[model samples]
Target: MSSDTQQGRFEGKIALVTGAGSGMGAAVARQMAAEGARVVVLADVNGEAAAAVAKELSVGRAVPLDVADGAAVDAAVEDVVREHGRLDVLVHAAGVDDPEAKQLIADALVEGRPPEVTDRLGDSAWRRVMRINLDGTFHVLRAAVRVMRPVRAGAIVVIGSSCVFDTPVGYPHYAASKAGVHALSQAVAKEVIASGIRVNVVAPGPTETGMAARTPDVLRGGFADPRVRPYATPEEIADIALFLASDSAANLVGAVLLANGGRFTA
Candidate 1:
């Protein structure tokens, strides 16, 4: 636990975090537990990974989930509510960046070849990214909303990408998916606020995570500039996410907070 943790900030809160197997999702779970959440359900596609992180928490449980599967997502959320009685917080962070496509573009750039990544993009690649990144978000968000609506009290913080604003040449599909997430979050926020649910987005840029680790050196060279920091740590992003999920951000709803370390000011 960090010294700065709000100590019991989330006491008695029941929280659910998707993608909790690693990266920002795992960080959020840890912090929520440290802050005294009653229970933090860690859901991920990788059951073992989620269970590993669950062991680190005082009140954590692991649930294997494929966010792309709407039925499974709904069941998972329903199960949490049924077991815990109520859900107070939701952090939807499960997503993909399509490392294979990125690698292809990187190789082309290195070899001085036309990197027509989009032109060569097959249906499988495009659909896979959309299914996991965009469709999965919808599945999770909708499920959370269904339960939270009746309770008339909840907080949702979605992990979006700065790529949505400043398009990345290597990841059109990722950018598009995140854009949909941002828009969906805002729209849903408006609908749910009257019912006492708060929804917001954290759009981060080049975070240091497993996803970023897979990025080729050719594409990661920009981070080498000494004038600017390379990437935000998972903890840093988690801090913002927790803030949105906490009472501290009560005034925030449908807001997209960008954590790009000044990488994109606009």
Candidate 2:
């Protein structure tokens, strides 16, 4: 008889995943664990969901976190470092959505161009989008750097979007936020090499998660070319993230690794 224990490639590293309550974050956390990471801290704005994911992963370190809150972000980093003694992997998956901008994106897809913004594009919409998608990733990266730089060893995988390139029919704000993520990864990869900390972006497209189902229909069918299918699963994208987090991608700093099944390439 063969043993069926799932083994990890990460074997003994400590990882922290934000937005681990669901979607790609949860998937990434599970994959990291399976690949041999000894410890995983699941952090989410929704404490119960985070805890559940931690339990599902069978790890005990689930935490409540609001990535938009700088103090909370800092504390979470400190807690992970203090408890784990060192940090080896960081995954930023926490984020928010903008239905208004999404509508614009979808309209552009269905109508072939964005409808005129006759004053309905609220300032609040822009700020909230930046607050979570952009600012949230910033806070996590900044806090992780403080700890990882000290050890002179770490890898950060930011969850970005295909929209940055394909401009997914809706969610312009999401696309813009992801574009900022790509730029930040490139800048930090340069800034952190001296400290032996690497930063990279993994932009996944049309993953088959709850979030995908909620995506604007125009956005979903936008990749309508018969030759290319855009849909992916969280587990599928997680495998890519696992490689990026592992030693295999040691030289892959500042890379915008795409895992979109040839949607844009085609």
List candidate 2 segments past 4 Å from native: 1-6, 104-114, 117-119, 168-171
Give model 1 RMSD, 1 decimal.
Answer: 1.1
Error of 1 at 46 (Å): 0.3
Query: Candidate 1 lDDT, tens digit per residue, 181-218?
Result: 99999999999999999999999988888988888998
Clashing pairs in 1: none
Task: Specify the highest-TM-score model's number.
Answer: 1
Estimated TM-score per prediction?
A: 0.97, 0.90
Model 2 residue 183 CA deviation (Å) reads: 0.4
Would you list the C-alpha lDDT of every candidate in the order shown? 0.92, 0.81
Cα RMSD (angstroms) for every candidate in the order listed: 1.1, 3.2
